[model samples]
Target: MDFYELVKQRQSTRAFDTERMVDREIIARILEAGRLSPSACNAQPWHFIVVDEPDLKNKVADATSARLLGMNHFTKQAPVHIIVVEEKVNFSSGIGGLVKDKHFAFLDIGIATAHICLAAESEGLGSCILGWFKESKVKELLNIPKNKRVVLDIIIGYAAQPLREKRRKSSEEVISFNTYQ
Candidate 1:
């Protein structure tokens, strides 16, 4: 699908078929999309943990409270969960001082997450970006170092239900000609 079409069709899928599993190659593509995202000064502070093992997924679900996006129980049933984290020490700091920009890491991770979601939609897979979680517990469970911070969790699988339409503000309400009202 084209970029516009993918953006229009992408929706947060909550209900997923437990039996359906995403192909490893497809998952790799999704990860590559994230890895290729642009970052401040190309710091590339993001790291990913792909959890496909049932036991680990279940642990993440349990630690995430299983109610991340309202009553979305299928989040726990997804065949794969991609955890996105940001490293504190920027590897590309030698180019400049991108590491000093503390908030840049989160921004970079957000861009990467967006790429992953778009790629998943393009590949006919369902996904949901989850943020509500106990970060410390997740870090411990995932064996993430203290220097890295969990930014987002993406659940991937085949949808079990139809995509639900969400409400959005009209352009007129959110846009301005040159200045804020």
Candidate 2:
């Protein structure tokens, strides 16, 4: 599919086929897409931990569960989980961030993840970018260092749910020309 079509088709897939296993090559390609993403001053401050093992995947899913909200209950059905970690930024990016007073690392990571999800769509796989999870528990389970921040937990597999209509603000409602509306 074309880029626009891919973007339109990509959605946060909640339900996945538990029996199917994702190919390592496809996951590699998805990560490669993330690696090629642009970052502030080319810092590329990101690390991806791919979890395909059943035991580890379950552990990660456990960290994502919440009884009150009932969110992320479908994660256990996903076959793969990619944990995105934020690393130290390069000097140039750091200085840029300081001057701009913005966290460039987060922005860079978001861009990288966009590439990952888009690539997954291109590979005929489904994905969900999950943020509402127990970060400390995830860190402990994955053996992540204390300093590193877990930015996102992405699940990938064949989608068990059908695509739903997308609701969004139209261009006229969200876009402006030459100046803020």
Candidate 3:
């Protein structure tokens, strides 16, 4: 698929087919996209933990949803969840971030997240990037080290819902050429 079209096709899929499972090959490709994503100063600074086992996936899904708040309640319907863990950046990337007052690790991870979502879309799978989960619980469940941080959980599956049109700001509102016009 065309890159532009892939970006347009990628959306936060909320409803997913409960029965269909995402193939391992497709998941591998999506992960490959993440692995090859560009990073500052060659610091990858991210690790992905894939959860596809029925019982464990449900437990991770539980960590993501809040019943009273009605947030991410549908995460359990998806067959897979890929947890993104933030890692330390290279020396130069860390120094550059400190000097520039920016978090290069997060920026790099965000780019990887985009690559993952687009890759999933290209593979005919739906995905949702979830950031509002219980991080501590997830780490404990997955045996992640205390020092590492869980950044995001991405759920993937066949979408059960129809495509919804994307609403976005006009190009003029978000874009500015030379001199920030």
Q: How does model 3 score by TM-score?
A: 0.97
TM-score of each: 0.88, 0.98, 0.97
- Per-structure clash totals for the candidates: 0, 0, 0
lDDT score at residue 51, model 1, on the 0-100 scale: 93
* Lowest-sum lDDT 10-residue window in model 1: 93-102
Per-residue accuracy of model 3 over 60-130 as CA lDDT, tens digit each: 99999999999999999999999999999999999999999999999999999999998899989999999
Candidate 2 per-residue lDDT, tens place, 19-80, comes to 79999999999999999999999999999999999998999999998867898999999999
Clashes of 2: 0
Q: Considering every candidate listed, which one attains the maximal lDDT?
A: 3
lDDT of 1 by residue, 1-181 (tens): 7799889888988888888889999999989999998987788888899999999898887766645455545568888889988775355653445436457777788899999999998999888998877899889999998877788889988888886776899898999988995
Instruction: Between candidates 1 and 3, name the one with more favorable lDDT.
Output: 3
Model 2: colliding residue pairs: none
lDDT of each: 0.83, 0.94, 0.95
Residue 109 displacement in candidate 3 (angstroms): 0.5
